[model samples]
Each structure stands twice: as C-alpha cells, then as structure tokens.
Target: MEKQSRHIFSKVFTNAVLIIFSLSCIFPLIWMFYSSLKEKRVFNADVVGLPSNPTLKNYKRILENPDYHIFDSMFNSLRTTFLSVLLIILCGFIVGYIIARVQFKLNRVIYFVFLLGMLIPIHSLLVPIYIVFKNAGLTDKWYTLIIPYVAFGLPIAIFLVEGFVKGIPVALEEAAAIDGSSFSRTLFSIILPVTKPILTTIAIIQTFACWNEFSFALVLLSETRLQTVPLAMKQFSGQFSSDYPKIMAAMLLTMSPIIIMYFVFSKQIIKGMVAGAVKG
Candidate 1:
C-alpha cells in the first residue's frame, strides 16, 4: 500500500510539472494571438487583459498593404526553406549512407569533418561568408541564402542520418544486391524508405532553422523585395510610433504555418527526434 501510494504521488507530480511546462511554452503564443485581435489602443492599455473590443483590422491591414509584402516574403521563405531542406536531405543521406555502409579509411575522416562543422559557431562564419558572397557577386540573391542554409544544415542532418543508417540491417542491402539492384537503386528503394523517420526529423529541424534564421538573411539580402518574414517583421516596426497589435498580428501570421505543421506532424516529430537521438 505504501509503494502504491508513492507511485501515485510520483505520477501526479510528473503530470503537474509537465502541465506547467506546457503552459509556460504555450502562454506566450496565446498572449500574442489575443493581442493581435485587440485594437492598437486596447493592446497598449492592457497588455495582458482580455480585450473588450476585438478587431481583425490588424490582419486586414497587413494583408492589404502593398508595402508590407507579407505574402511575397512568405513565398520567399517557403522557397528557400523547402529547397534548402531538400538539398540537405539528399546530400546528407548520400554521405551518411556511404559512411555507414562503405568500408573506406577516409569515410570516418569525412564523417568526423562534418561533425567538426557543428562545433563551429555560425555567427563566426558570417563575416567571411559575407565577404566571399560579396566577392562572388552573390549578395542579395536567393541562391546565396540557399547555399549557406544547406551548408549549415548539413552537419546535423548527416549526424542524424548516419546514426539512423548504422542501425539499419545489412541483410536488406545484400538481398537487393543479390536481386541485381545497383547501389543507387538499392539506396532509394530499400534504404531511404526505412530512414523516413529520421529524414522527417531532419526536415523538421532544418525547416525551423531556415525559417526563423534572421542573421544570415539580414546580412545576405539587401533588396526590399528579397526580404523574408523575419526581416519584414523588423520593418513592421514604425519609426515614429509602433503598433503593438499590428506587430503581434504579423508575428502570429508569420508563425502560423509552422505551428500548423508542428501540430499536424507532432507524432512524426517526436518519433524521429527520439529515434535519431537514441541511434545517433
């Protein structure tokens, strides 16, 4: 009876802690969403209070304003994120597979090099990256962003993929080889499908990084038309007077897609993260 009581107490304590943590993470988003619905005056008057007068004018104004370019920035972010993540997955998978399956003296060395990249702070590379891009006449280009995003994302992607790949049974590849399948054919057909969970994990992480990245975008992109969501949000702040409600509304809009995506793929995300962390 004492043991049973202890177990129940432990479980209840754990649940209470989890609920508190969840609320802490969620409350800010809830506040932002609520503030977005409030009038500018109401938001400033009562930052945390329930709005007596809710309004959608903030959303309507942001969407209708030509200078805001929220839609264009959204498209650019989507394009950059999707293409960069796609490349990272493809390249990381190929490299990870080779390291895991191919028996070569240099394979471990190459894998170690990728792991070393993770140790290098991205901020440290910004100056050199800017100078090189400037010299190459690549500044303000979408490809510039794509290249660096893929480069930064590769190290972790390779780590996750390689870890997951190591746990895959070799017999599957042997069976494929026996059936007259080429190495590439075996990889796509047998290996990739099995690695889907880790791949999804990589995609989710890289997507979030690329989507939220502001430093690289700020330095690399100069043109107003090329600005991404983060940069656009920075510009949303008026010089003379800040509209807190409008800013909050824009932020909510900027993060909505990712939030929806997270909710939709929450299960896959949890599975992938756990599996990758464990295997890697």
Candidate 2:
C-alpha cells in the first residue's frame, strides 16, 4: 500500500510538471495567434492581453493585397520544399541501401565523404558558395536554393536510412532472390514497403529543414518575385515595423502549414525515430 501510494504520487507529480512545461511552450504560439487578431494600436497598448475585438483585416490585407505577394512566396516555398524533400528521400534511400547492403572497396570512402559534409559548418562555406554560384551564373535561379537544401539534407537522411536498412533482416532479401525476383524488383517491391516508417521520418525532417532554412535562401535568392517564405517574412518586418498585428498575422500564416504537418505526422515521427535509433 505504501509503494502504491508512492507510485501514484510520482505519477501525479510528473503529470503536473509536464502540463506546466507544455503550457509554457505553447503560450507564445497562442499569444502570437491571438495577438495577430488585434490592430497595431491594440497590440502596442497591451502586448500580453487578448484582443477584445478580433478582426481578419490583417489576414485579408496580406492575402488579398497584390503588393504583399504572400501567395507567391508560399508557392515558391512549397515548390522548393516539395522538390527537395522528394529528391532527398529517393536519393538517400538508394545510396544508404547500397552502402548498407553492397560490398565494395570504395564504399567506405564514399560514405566518409558524405559524412564529412555534416561535420563542416555551412556558414563557413557561404562566401565560397556565393563566388562559385556567381561565376557559374547559377545565382537567382529558381533551383538555386534547392541544390544546397538537397546537399545539406542528404547526409542526415542517408545516415538514418543506412542505419534503418542495416536493422532489416538479410533473410528477406535472400528469400526474394530465391523466388527469382530481379534485383530492382526485390528492392522496390520487397524492401521498399518495409522502410516506410524510417523514410517517412526522413521526409518530415528534411521538409522542416528545407522550409525553415533562411540563411541559404537569403544568400542564394535575390529577386522579390522569387522570394521564399523566410526571405519574405524578413523583408515584411523591415517594410512594416509599425504594423505589429500584420506582422503577427504574416508569421502565423507562414507557421500554419508546418504546424499542421507536425500535428498530423507527430506519431509517425516519434515511432520512426525510436525504431531507427534503437532497432539498428
């Protein structure tokens, strides 16, 4: 009875702590959201207080106004993020599978080279990358940010996929081989289905990375017509310092997609991370 009481007390204590922590983390987001509904004067008058009269004017202005171009920025961000995530997942799985399953002399060398990328600081290479892009005439292109996004994203993607693939039984592949399944057929049909969880996790991770990436986007892109969400948000702040409510609205708009994605895929993310990290 004493031990049972102790366990119950501990559970209560942990739950209380967790509830507080969660509320603390979520408070800023809630504040930002509600604050977005207020006018600039209201927000300035009482930053922490809730809006007594919420309005959709900020949202309408940003979305409906041709000058803001919020829609265009969203489209650019979506396009780059979608393309980058797709390529990262496809290439990461293929290369990681090869490195894990194949026996070759240069495998370790290639793996080492890829791993070297993660160790290097991206900020250190900005000047060099800019010079290279300038000389190559690749700057300001639609695909400029996509290249680095894929390149930087690949190392971690490959690492996770390689580890997860290693955890999968070799017997599965061997059994498929015995059935006279061609190599491509076995890889795509037999092995691919088994890797869904880890791949989903990789996709989510790379999506967040590509979407939130600001520095690379800033360095690689210049045209207002081609601006991504991060760049546009930054520029928005500079252009509308007085309009606090509109700024908050713009931030909320930018945050909505990622927030929705996280809530939907939250379970898959936790499961995949645990499986990939522990199983292998």
Candidate 3:
C-alpha cells in the first residue's frame, strides 16, 4: 500500500512539472495569438490582459497589404524547404549508404569530411558564401537558398542515415545481390523502403531548420519577391514600428503552417528517433 501511494505521488509530481513547463513554452504563442486580435493602443496599454474588444483589422490589413507579401514569403519558404529536404534526403541517403556498406580507399576520409561540415559553424561562412554567390551571380535567385540549406542539412542527415543503415542486416543486401538484382534495383527497392523512418525524421528536422533560417536568407536575398518568412517578417516590423498587435498578426500568420505540421506529426517524429526503430 505504501509503495503504491509513493508511485502515485511521484507520477502526480512529474505531471505537474511537465504541465507547468509546457505552459511556459506555449504561453508566448498563446499570448501572441490573442494579442494579435487587439488594436495597437489596446495591446500596448494592456499587454498581459486579453483584449476587451477583439478585432480582425490586423489580419485584414496584412492580407490586403500588397507591400507585406506575407503569402509570397510563405510560398517561397514552403517551396525552398520542400526542395531542400528532398535533395538532402536523397543525397544524404546515397552518400551515407556508400559510407556504411562499401569498401574504398577514401571512405573514412570522405565520411569525416561531412562530419567536419557539422562541426563547423555554418553561419561563419555567411560572408564568404555571399561573396562567392555575388561573383557567380547566384544571389537573389529562387534556387539560391536551397544550396546552403541542402549543404548544411546533409551532414546531420548523413550522420543519422549512415548509422541507421549500418544497423540494417547485411544478409538482406547479400541475398538481393545473389538473386541477380541490379545495384539500382536493390538500392531503391530494398534499402530505400526500409529507411523511411530515419528519412522521415530527417525531413521533419530539416524542414523546421530550413524554414526558420534567417541569417542566410537575410544575406543572400535582397529582392522583396525573393524574401522568405524571416525576411518578410522583418519588413513587417520595420513597416509597423511600435504596432505590436499588427506585428504579432504577421508572425501568427507566417507561423501557422509549421505549427499545424508539428502538431500533426509530433507522434511520428518521436517514433522515428528511437534507436533501431527505423526498421521496426
């Protein structure tokens, strides 16, 4: 009876702590959402309290304002994030598979090179990449952000995928080979399907990373049409100084898709990260 009582107490304590922590994390977003519905004066006057008179004027203004380009920035972020994740998963899987399965002279060396990319701070290369892009006329293009997103994203993807592939049974591949399956056929048909969990994990992670990236987008993209979420949101602040309500509206609008995606995929994400569960 005492042991049962102790377990109940512990579980309750743990739940209380978790609830508090979750509230702390989500409170800001809740505040932002409700605060967005207020007028500028009401928000500034009572930042903590709910608005006595909720209004949709801010939302209407952002949607109707041609200068804001909120929708365009959103589309750009989605397009770039999708393409970058696709390329990262594809390239990372291929390179990671080779490093895991093949024997070669420079195998370790090449794998370590990607590991080095993870070690190095990507933001440190901002100026150099900008310079190179400028010289090569690659800056401010639709594809410009995709390059860095894929490059930086590859290291982690490759690391996770290589480790995951290493755990896959070697007998499976050998059997495929013995059955006279071509390399491409075996790769795509057998190995690729089994790698879905880890790949899904990589896609989710890199989607958030690429979408939220601000520095590279700020440096590489100058044109308004080419601007991404962070960039357009920056313009939102600049264009509406001290108007906290309107700025929050812009942020809430831009943040909705990612928030929805996270809530939807939260379980799959947790499942994918478990060790050796990729094949399970």
Candidate 4:
C-alpha cells in the first residue's frame, strides 16, 4: 500500500510539473496571438488582459499594405528553405552511406571532418564568407543563401543519416550485391526507402533552421525584393515601432506554418528521433 501510494504520488507530481512546463512554453505564443487582435493602445495599457475589443485591422494592414510585402517574403523564405533542405538531404544521404558502408581508410577521417564542422562557430566565419561572396560578385543572390544554408545544414543531417544508415542491417546490402545490383542501384532501390523516417527528421530540422535564420539572411541579402520573413518582421519595428499589435500579428503569421507543420508531424518527429537514438 505504501509503494502504491508512492508511485501514485510520483506520477501526480510528474504530471503537475509537465503541465506547468507546457503552459510556460505555450504562454508566449498565446499572448502574442491574443495581443495581435488588440489595439496598440489597448495592448500598451493592458498587456496581459484579454482583448476587450478584438479587431482584424492588424492582419489586414500587414497583408494588404504593399510596403509590408509579407507574402512575398514568405514565398522567398519557403523557396530557399525547401531547396536548401533538398540539397542537404541528398548530400547527407550519399555521404552518410559512404561513411557507414565503405571500408576506405579515409572514411573515418572524412566523417570526423563533418563532425568537426558542427564545432565551428558559424558567426566566426560570417566575415570571411561575406568577403568571398563579395569578391565573386555573388552577394544578394538567392544561390548565395542556398549555398551557405546547405553547407551549414550538412553536418547535423549527415550525422543523423549516418546513425540511421548504421542501424540498417548489412545483410540487406549483401543480398542486393548477390542479386547483381550495382552500388548506386542498391543505394536507391534498397537503402533509401528504409531511410525515410530519419530523412523526414532531417527535413523538419533543416526547414526550421533555414526558415528562422536571421543573421545570414540579414548579412547576405541586401535587396528589399529578396528579403525573407524574418527581415520583413524587422521592418515593422523600423517603420511602425509603436504598433505592437501589428508586430505581434506579423510574428503569428510568420510562425503559423511551422507551428502547423509541427502539430501535423509531431509523431513523425518523435519517432524519427527515437529511431536515430536507438540506431546510433
């Protein structure tokens, strides 16, 4: 009876803590969304109070105003994130497979090189990258952002992919070899299908990173036409500094897609991380 009571107490305590943490995590987003519907004056007067008179003016202003160009920036961010993640996944898969399966003496060294990349402070290299791009006349170009996004995204993607690849049984490759499959054929036909979960994990991770990235986008992209969502949000502060409602509305708009994505694929994300952890 004592043990049963102790277990019940523990479970109850754990749940209480979890509920508190979850509320803490979600409160900011809730506040931001609620505050977006309020008048700037109302929000300033009662920052935490429920909106007494909700309005859609903030949304309308942000969406309809040509100066905001929120939709265009969203499109640019989406385009860059998707293309960069695709390249990262493809490169990560190929490199990960080679490191996992190939028996070359340099394989370990190559893998360590990628691991080392994760240790390097990305900010430290920003000046040099800017200089190189400036010299090559590639600044402000879409590919300029895409290239660095892929390069920085590779280390984590490769690490995850390699862990997943190692978990796959070697006998499957041997069987494919015996059946007269070429290496590339074996990789595409036999390996890639099994790697979908971890790939999904990589895609989600890289997508978020590329989407939320500000420093690189700010430094590399100078043209207003090429600005991403993060940069567009910065504009609200510059011109409409006191318009808290509009800024909050813009933030909710910017983060909505990612939030929806997480809700939809939350299971897949958890499964992928667990699978990688077990395999690795």
Clashes of each: 0, 0, 0, 0
lDDT of 1 by residue, 1-280 (tens): 9999999999999999999999999899899988999998888789999888788999999999999999889989989998999999999999988888899878888999999999999999999999999999999887779999999999998988888888988998998989999988999988998898889888988998999999999999999899998999998787899999899999989888888888998998999888766665
The candidate that achieves the highest lDDT relative to the unseen native structure: 3
lDDT, candidate 3, equals 0.91
Which stretches in model 1 have alpha-carbon errors above 4 Å? 239-241
Per-residue lDDT tens digits for candidate 3, residues 87-172, read: 99999999999999999999999999999999999889999999999999999999999999999999999998899899899999
Ranking by lDDT: 3, 1, 4, 2
| lDDT (10s digit) by residue, model 2, range 130-173 | 99998999999989998988999999888878888888999999
| Candidate 2 Cα misplacement greater than 4 A, ranges | 239-242
**Which RMSD does model 4 reach against the true structure?**
1.8
Per residue, candidate 4 scores C-alpha lDDT tens digits across 141-168 of 8677898999999999899888889889
Using lDDT as the yardstick, the better of models 1 and 3 is 3
- RMSD of every candidate to native, in Å, equals 1.8, 1.8, 2.0, 1.8
- Go through the candidates in order and give each one's C-alpha lDDT: 0.91, 0.88, 0.91, 0.90
Residue 126 Cα positional deviation in candidate 3, in Å, after optimal superposition: 1.2
TM-score of each: 0.93, 0.93, 0.94, 0.93
